[model samples]
Target: MSCYDTNIYKVARLKAGKTQEGAAEALGISVESLKAYESYSRLPPAGVVDRMCVIYDALYLAYQHNRIASGDVKVIPEIEVLDLPRASIRLINRVIQFAEKRRDRELLTIAEDGVISPEERPLYEEIVAELDGLIQAAMELKVAEAKEL
Candidate 1:
């Protein structure tokens, strides 16, 4: 089954600090509509799902994990969401490690000079570009899979 078949909306709503009435109002959607999505009685519009990501990627990921754990969702490796608990865990971990090290080094540099020098800026820019590719790959994969479903 697709995660669209699961309680991901409800779970994500809660993870996003729920406040359904307020959130629904803010999103310019009726409370009933939000409730329907959470109950799995209605498929959220693509725009709503996209907006939800802005609120909580971790929660959405957790929802994906739940769907996979239930033995109902098959992850198409190349098109998978970043299923961090699976083999993708290694890649995700590497990204996190890379980011942490980059942050530490950048902080150390800034601590010394109180500003990024032109030379140091290029190093940070390099890290940013590399991370952007890795992050975009996962995001594009998610979008691709969603389109397929």
Candidate 2:
């Protein structure tokens, strides 16, 4: 038997106020199978893992909504701020516009070049910093959305 921590499953079950048998019925699995998972006697299959994630996400959202309604925590939808460099944003915009017009991968080459003019170096650096922020924000957004679902 593969030893895997079924922490996620246990947490989800607890959060939903479900016993092992109850969760197994909800998930269309045998109670013994659910017990095996909770005890780490066996690892769930890939399909079970995917289903568990979906169920957990839905349960998490419902829990959050309930908590908010009960005034347990202030309901604040998370917002991520991206402070990308103006120059980079402008360059990206220009590239997008060019691509829209010409519809070629060649234009992307110009965008990928690191040969910034001396005067544009500072702007480029700022854009790079902003790009980092943007990427972080996007990742955060994805996490938030996943939790919401």
Q: What lDDT does candidate 2 reach at residue 33?
A: 92
**Per-residue alpha-carbon lDDT of model 2 for 22-128, expressed as tens digits?**
77877789999988876657767756755665655433333322333344443333223223343345446655654565534432443567566676567556555
Task: Estimate TM-scores for all models.
Answer: 0.41, 0.40
TM-score of 1: 0.41
User: Each prediction's Cα lDDT score?
Assistant: 0.60, 0.53
Q: What digit string (tens of lDDT, one per residue) describes model 1 on residues 1-149? A: 54456577666667678688876876678999988877767767767766665655433443353444456443422224444344255446657877777765765765596777877887777666656556655654455444344
lDDT of 1 at 108: 70
lDDT of 1 at 133: 53
Show model 1 residue runs off by greater than 4 Å. 1-6, 57-149
